[model samples]
Target: MRFWMVFAWLSSALLLAVAQETVLTDDALHKPITVWQRLASLAEVLDDIRKQTGVPLRCQDALREMKLAVYVQNRPAREILEQVASLFGLRWRRDDDGSYVLYLPDETRRALERAQRDDRAATERALREMLRIAREWLRLPPEARAEAMAPFAQTREYPANMPYSAYLMEEAAAQRQMTQEQRVKALVADYLSGYSPQGEPSKPKRDAFFSEEDTQGSLLHCLSEAGDAIVNRLLEGHTLGFSTRPTPDALPLPPRVLLPFWMRHAQLSDESVLQFDAASGQFTEVQPLPNPDWGGYWVRLSAWGNSLEYMVVALRVYELDGKTQKFLNKVDYQLHLPHQEYLAETETWRQWEAWATPMEDWTARLKERTPLERPKPTVNNERPLLAADALEWLAWHTGYPVISDASRYVPAWYRDSLDSPRALLTLLSNDLWLRFDPNGYLLARHKRFWTLNQFEIPERIVRPLEAKWLAWQWLSLDDYATLAAAITDEQARGFTRVRRRGSIQFWTAFDNDPLYYELPALRFWASLSAAQRQRALAGEWIPESALTLPQRKLFRAALYREFPPPEQLLRDLPDDYEVGLYVPSVFRSEGVPESRSEALKQSPDAPAFRVLQQNPVSELSVLKYKDELGRRTYTLHEVKTQVSREGVDWKKVFQEAGYEGEPAEAILKTVLDTILQFALPPRMFEQYILNQSRYADFGRHAAP
Candidate 1:
């Protein structure tokens, strides 16, 4: 394969060159210079080589051998001898018996032999020189080189009769004969003519139009005209049949032999069956058969949309010949819907049915002695939990409240922690307030503070509370009833009361605010044990408070002056000092009103009172600072509206906003116009108005 490939490549190259040359003019085919002048021109080359390598050039025979070696190694085999002849300024010709000859100059032969016998360095130098001479000789005009070494350069003969030269000559001749177009035409013609000497003749045909010769010719011609088309068709696939002659002494058909037949009916369920008359091969009746678990013998039929819609049929044939029953089987056959339609249209199925109906009829003829019964289907009914009931149950059990604040309106809840003030605050914010009975029992709750504006709380405590709530909600009714009963009875009368009055309050000393009244204060003072309360009251739990006004101011100044604490503490009181006047009138009058009035009257020479400075109040100042910051930092963009035919002119709006036609200005104007047109809700508007003040300065200096 490899040799043929190389041969094909070389042959193609040679043919291509010939074809190209044939189209060129004579001037384009420059005749190479004769060999002799080329050899003579080598003297200058030898002188140059000697200069480079310090070796004397010698011997025509040695030079010829070096040229031969180089040509053999570098050039392709066919071009080797020709290249050698060109290098030596010689031309080669084959003798009548076919042998290669090399002609060289007399002086060159002697010089080459002398160089060959020298030392290693000398031999290498000599080889280089000869190579240089060969190169120089190759450069000379073909005609000039052919004359210089005519006498000394004669053809030489090898010992044996090698056919390599003959082969090359033949190959060259053959390549010159055919162009690519000519080869294609010849190959096609030969194929069409059916000139194959290697292929055996196909079986002879009796028909007059299909004689052996004619068939072969026609097949070949068809293939030649459409070989690729035929191969492709065959590769795609074809249907063929193989017929074999049956032996004459075949055993009689088995009695009760099982022949599986598939029916391609449009509506045959798995239980559907067709009864056939074996003698007439015709279908008699159609019936549905009960599925049986008999091993190795079964039939399945299915139809579209029905459980048994698409049909697959199988059956076991039993021989019932006198007492000993045996089974005989045939290969299963499938009848597809499309194929069935074709067969039905062609009346094939009718014919097949006519022949097989008797067999099916006979097989199904047996009547069962016992009647079969089908089992009844079982039904179950159960109900799922209702969402409202579930939430109520969860709330009752876990002491948690559900709040719905999301747009989707899905209600969610978190378990309440009795010990966490934050949790209680969250509940209060959501208007889901809770209270305990006098004895610490849970009571009916109010949702005013817990559900109104509740915010998200931490998950760590919430999750446990939620779990407990869920568990309480899911507890068995019997368990809950039992607990309820126990609570109602006198046996549990000492338990915590399920109702408390003062627990829910506002705006008093026990108000639910962080400053003077909060859950921690209540839990610390009222809820803790006596010992714990005492310990906490003794300052272990209480943090030190900053000194009041005048005392603080005086201490601050004195400390700044670096006076010792003992000295500052011992300093005499100012003559006109009045501590009651220095305290805020609200704290003094409301917190210690009677005492403050009495002290003021007794101190008649006290310094006159100074009114407290009132901080400035503005619309922005009245708004919560954090709420303003949140509004500025977290955007509450209005829902975007669809474009209207008379939508606000963005360009005009941008101009009004002091933008001098910047591209994004138009977008910003459009956004603001849309926002203004949408009209926010009252609360949302307040928030937006407040935030706008904070961002107003930013908008004022922003780049257009």
Candidate 2:
């Protein structure tokens, strides 16, 4: 019987499962299991109603399993089913038997949707309120409102119920001591009039909205104004009013508001700005004041043992006319250094290294005392004198050559000029005589070389004694004195006793003449018979018949062509002899000589009638002679004399050649030939002569 019962139960479970599947219809199968599936299957109807409408309803899991009648609310079943499907995770689908299948859960789906919707609405309302508050704040004047409201503007959120105006008023009151009504008026005035340090204007006709006078109604206002005046006076005193500090705080009782205003302007909010009274150098009583347009102002005060050390005061005031806001900042600083303290500090660092020591001590001392009262300027007496080794070290460090001229020397006048023993020591230490004594003495005596002009002294000496004498010159004097002081024998003559040569000037003459000669014999030799020329070329056959005086001279001239005389020999030779030899043709007159009276008459200075009558010798010719074999070689010289050419005149030629056109005509050519003779090489001499012709042609063309 137990076996039968177990089998029967399993069969029942399987049947019920099949019935559930068969109940779904073909239409339900065609449709998807979606939010609207509940309306297509009655079994899911009540579950769907609860979910979709947020209403609790009865559900029958056993009836659903058995495929019995499914109950639902009286509301439109389709609507209820749709709502249930949407609210809860339920759906419908068609089964193989053409029956609809409904899936449902226990919870009310519609109630959850309602709660979510309400939450979303409330959030949205809060966001709207926040946005409204921000808009209101933005509409408020920037000068009247605080910067705290800026974050709200960025997020655009506000409290849901509070009025925007009321919020703004609260913010203003917190930042500034002002009532609600007063805040509105002030912000409105600030918005319309822009930043106005003075109170808002009563009448709107004129653009002027406010003045400082209008803001004087409040106690803070009076205090701030009074503080401003006092700080201004302090700044003036520190800078322009007087160099000295006042005896006491002369202004009226410190303005309560002004103290905060000054502190704010100075940026003394940090604790670092203030210090203990015993600290002496510490600042105290730091505070900051609010500025309408530009943040706040800061100020601070510091004391130095028994006296106020320093005070910084400032205020941010808006200038309406200039349309600018500026911090009128001022500082009062006083340094009080007791004499004993200063002396102690000075002694502590008296021997300190020059490079590492602070300049504060030196600068302070300079400011505190007059020049007369201060210690005289002194070179560090303890500094070791620069010996040769020291100097070598310095030279190595500086990378410059130390020359002999930088030797030690002292002048008698230097000894007389010393004002004190310390000064004298400095003079002696720097004196080349003491510093470079042995070396300077040895160089002066043995080398006979002074460092005066050749060697430059190091800057140490050059900067001081550079005006009158050189380093070596001074060195010589110092060494002489030092040597004299050390010498045991009074009779021993010092280096100074040695007479020195004074500077002297001398004159000399320079000779720069070139030798010149003709080569007529060489030319004649070329003209000889080839057999005769060959015989001449051969040493065996010689011209036994001695040459005539003129021929011998010509031969000598030919020898000169091969080998010219030295310039000294040429300069010693008679000028006339040189001219007659190589330059004979240059001196020959190209034209026949005319009487001076006739020449003058034909000159340009002559009367026009006399010029017309005179033939004005336009052409000239000359005969040139040279010594040859027992005969004179003659050559005809022709010169085409230009009378007044169309474009050029004799005056133009003289001017173009940079000549004054002196009467001594041959002298000019002689000088020019002399210069060219030595300046040009033998190969270039002919080219130079040819170039002269080219120059003449250029001059002729250019003449006007």
Candidate 3:
């Protein structure tokens, strides 16, 4: 029997029920710290923190070897934990001990008791779906089963149309784009006689060990699910089968070789059933396997929004043998799949450091054309209306969901009528680009961002580039009981990590945009003097640095609490799935743009004074994209859009509306006659992130 056959048997036989328990610790997750780490492996970063902070950060066997990039000057440990966890949609827990006790959220663990019945009920559907597929297979007659299995037996063609990953195309796009026909030919030729390999495959045993006494070097203890291949394979093969049992060993085994327990006689085979009968492991010494041939490619994503200059540092690929539930270590079978060795640029993720809509034309249209009553944005307070409130108000009235950046919108009275979805969206877009990035975001780019071999934009075109951001918002719940319950559990013991006033919480969605209405950093920034604001733009921020942590918290709560948070435009999502905020990235930046605050020449590291990009296309239609499971990523999802048609001096509007400070006019300007901006502020985000990081990154940027 083939070795792969045994894998099916093990998967079915070992139906291990993984049960986990967690105890609550005081709150080290919120431990504020100062650190700067660029491209590094997941283990190194976690270990370094443990060594420095004396608090151990850990991961499971599968993920220990993964590499990730993180650059944060000053942030809470919870953010770090959640950021990493969300990357793979992994669950986590915060235990009573200072160490990481589990891989689920503390909030999730606490809610377990209260939501045990509910969560159990919720997960039953997936199990039932699995059963349904198994039943379908079982119902077929033996002939039909053979027919179903025929596809596996049929010879496959390798080096078919290869799907290029962002990393692989980095250099290709730079060398010069080939014509479609020429490109296809080149892609095919890249896989040299791929379908007909001429080498014997390496057969690494499951345990990579012989009998107990036959001691040799240890094999790989853990393998990182690093590239696009691993993630795609897991998601694509999520449903498990109720497979058949293994066949009997053989007809004529060793007749009767009975031996005493002390004298166990056996053939010295170089294989073991257990993982070297696992005990302690030394992961650092685990060597990398050579490479593997591609079974097929995940051609799901296209090279649209990402800047083509994304460099591929390493190219690694692995094929998951479903029958064996193991990655074929380094078997080069000539079959090809362009699974890049780096992070797959997916779900509006253009690349590691940048995102954008393709240059192709797209007119914005609502998926749901049913008439929605146009509701004017109104708040409890008598102050001017904010852009976030408008989004929340529109989302509340209409069921459309919006993803926004953390950029702050200057507050001003909206005398314009929001009688139509287009009108309302156009008004909200202001100077920013209201693009359908498959999802809508208030996005824009300044000439200053593009770079390198590709986008070889001449120095002239690149120099005057403006800085911009596409802003979505954090999810919030108000006036809706269903959404409210989703954000928090009164039964849980730990303090909520979100902003709150009585029952209502702010920025519950991981995206930071919703915080604007909750905390208008722009309004506060505008209230400051001109000289202080300009100095902040020049990269030299001037703010009171000596405020205690408690004082800063009190000030943040008192000044911004009354304002509303952004309502998650969509209906509340199911548990374990929250709206994750993707901070903007750049095509040619060194690392994460938000992490590097030293870009004073292009734009200040403030919320408001960022990028402003929009292009009016001819038509609007949703991209027909699907997930690995072939499910539509967005079901019954629709968007409503409007572009900035005219200019409005947002700063003037603020001044007239009773603000005590000056406008941040330099951040955005009327560069074109028809083009316009609302005079947003980098001053306050500079104010906002500063007030928070002032104490953290203080020693470096201290006032003279």
Best by TM-score, which number?
3
Residues 1-704 of candidate 2 have per-residue lDDT tens digits of: 54454455335434544443443322322322212220122334345544554433343442241111111212243333333332223454444553334555343234334433443333333223322333344344544343533222212235644443345434534534544333333432332222222222221111122222222211122223342343333222221111011112222222222222232433323345333354343233322223322111111111111111232222344344566433333332321212112221221112111212132332332233222222332322211122222222222222222221222221212322223322232222322221111111110010111112112112322223322222211222222222222322211211110111111000001000110011122233323344543454342223313334554453343333332232211122222111111221333322312222222322333111000001112221111342322222333222333322132354544443444652222101111121001111121111001010101122111211
Query: What TM-score should be assigned to candidate 2?
Result: 0.12
From the highest TM-score down, the ranking of the candidates is 3, 2, 1
Candidate 1 regions with alpha-carbon error over 4 angstroms: 1-164, 192-222, 225-228, 231-704
Instruction: Estimate candidate 2's alpha-carbon lDDT, on a 0 to 1 scale.
Output: 0.26
Worst lDDT 10-window in candidate 2: 503-512
Q: What is the lDDT of residue 40 in candidate 3?
A: 39
Count of steric clashes across candidates, in order = 82, 52, 46
Across 1-704, the per-residue lDDT of candidate 1 in tens digits comes to 54554455345434543433332222312322211111112233333333433333323442321211110111122232233232233333333443323445453344334322322222233223322333333234544433432422323343333343333334445534665333333322322221111122222222211122222222232222322333233222221110011122111111221111221122233224455455543342243222211111111111100011111111222234453321111121111111111222222223223322132232222223121122211211111111122233323333332211111011212222323323323323232222222221111222211111122122222234334433322222122222223221222211111111112111111111221111111211222234533443342322112224533343233211111111122122122211111122221123221222333443223221111112111111111123321332221222122222244444444344444553311122111100000001110000000000011111222221
Could you report the Cα RMSD, in angstroms, for every candidate shown?
54.7, 53.9, 28.8
